[model samples]
Target: MAYVDSADRGRIRLRRSSLICPGDDTKLLGKMETVAADVCIVDWEDGVVPARKEEARRLTAEALQKAWRCPERVIRTNGMDSDLFETDVFAAVAAGVDSIMLPKVENAEQIIEANLLIDRAEQAAGREAGTVEVWALAETVQSVQNADAIAEVPRVTCLIFGGGDLGADLRLKRIQLGSNRTLGIHRYEYFYAYSRMITAARAAGIDIQVTGFTSYTDLDASREDAEISAQFGATGALAISPRQLPIYNEVFGPGADDLVWADKVLAAVDAAAAEQRAVVVVDGSMVDGPFIRNARFLRSLQDLIDAHDGSVG
Candidate 1:
């Protein structure tokens, strides 16, 4: 479900729920056929163990060649600083993935360098320039700080907020059972990082703003996380399990009440315009520039959902 960017530049994808599958896991990759996520990433980064990196690359490239039900097929490449970086990028590019998730990104120059590599791969593979989009992972504190510059890159279409990695970089305490996640209590710490990335992504006209941290099980907790993420302006979420997909999608999308409100606001605005007025009051609320913008954005999102759902059905 890709749409034109708000900046009137190019296309951006709608990823209400992005399911991450381990690259080396044949079983999981095979099971991807039965899932329904807006984006399915054959992860070559943290999800792949170092011992099986080659296997992951081979499997991911193979997976990309097959037609899957998911609209956006993407891969999360290893860090640019790593030796496997170029290998991962070239393989994914040649495989014709819809997007590349560059993980552990801490600056804009790394993404620029990645685009140079992507350019070479596109030319070598005889693919169109800019066919493959870049999705930057704002995991580190440095990346969060430089998110604006990173989002400004031309081919970059999405900013994946890497809350877990950012927590690790901040030296937050993790669970005792070798989990890299900080204690999930309250989860107020990542609000600042979320704010920085959300603002940067919006400024860059990237529509698919994402929260990239989740775990398996605990459906209640997943719903809470999804609701909180939506409250913070995230349009998408990274799902560790398929069970979380429906929860994320429902949380991020406009509800019946939202559509009702949008209908009323749009009607009010049309009425006011007919009366040659620039503003109108809807149920005691002023329908001005900001109100109109919100109404139109949500209405557009609902339309996208309807079209996509109809197509898939």
Candidate 2:
């Protein structure tokens, strides 16, 4: 689902899970249709070797043009300074992808340059301007420092935390990036960056996604990290492998208790609305503007799930 970001609406996309498929691998791309992910990102960056960048770009463009089961399809392009960046952007725009994920963003200037390149590509291909969105990669210290500025870029729809690269840049050990806790201290290693990223995204009314937890074989650890991320207000996390998808989806999806609360809140709001009232009480709790808004948002997720599975009945 495409997430609608706004101050009043909050994060509206069920990005509970996102899968990154290596663009050059046709076999992997073929499996994308069967995967249950909110977003399928055809990666043309780290997943593809430098020598095969062109092939990856070509494959990504082709994949984007074809129909897929995933709701939101995005192409993760090479960095703005790379030789393949222009070609990646041009192909993605020409193919009319849902969005272009630009990695290693440091400032608004890079976003502006990428947006301009996308604009030129769209015009050349006779496509509508702004048809393609931009997702900024906040992996570097510089990028984290200027996160608010980057979030202000008009083409940017979301900011992704590249935990692996960011952790390395901070000289943090691999274990530190995992779900290990020392003296009951959570992943303080990423506290500063996570705080800044979330704050910037919320302030700009955009979604912020988290990516890391390289231990694909360890579902428990990944779930721990995901729980912490949710507590810190991350909209979602990227699943590097197909095996990680279920864990992420479960972690981000609303639980049974959440649904029960939403049902009550929504029912009370409906009754109040029918009575020409703006407030109501449910389970000894006041149901007002905030309660009604949250209840509707929760129901939206169920609606999306039902639509995706053709289970609306």
TM-score of 1: 0.90
Per-residue C-alpha lDDT of model 1 across residues 185-234, encoded as one tens digit per residue: 24677778878888888888784445533555767777777777788877
Candidate 2: 10-residue stretch with minimal lDDT: 1-10
Q: Estimate, for each residue in 97-209, the C-alpha lDDT of model 2 and write its tens digit.
A: 87889999999998887777888888888876766777898998889999999998876778999877787888765635544545233577788999999999888877888
Model 1, 176: alpha-carbon shift in Å?
Answer: 10
Clashes found in each candidate (C-alpha, N, C closer than 3 A): 0, 0
In order, the Cα lDDT scores of the candidates are 0.79, 0.80
> Best candidate, lDDT-wise?
2
Work out candidate 1's RMSD over C-alphas: 3.4
Task: State the lDDT at 145 in candidate 2.
Answer: 97
Candidate 1 lDDT score at position 253: 85
Error of 2 at 207 (Å): 1.1
Q: Give the range where candidate 1 is weakest over 10 consecutive residues by summed lDDT.
A: 174-183
The TM-score between candidate 2 and the true structure equals 0.89
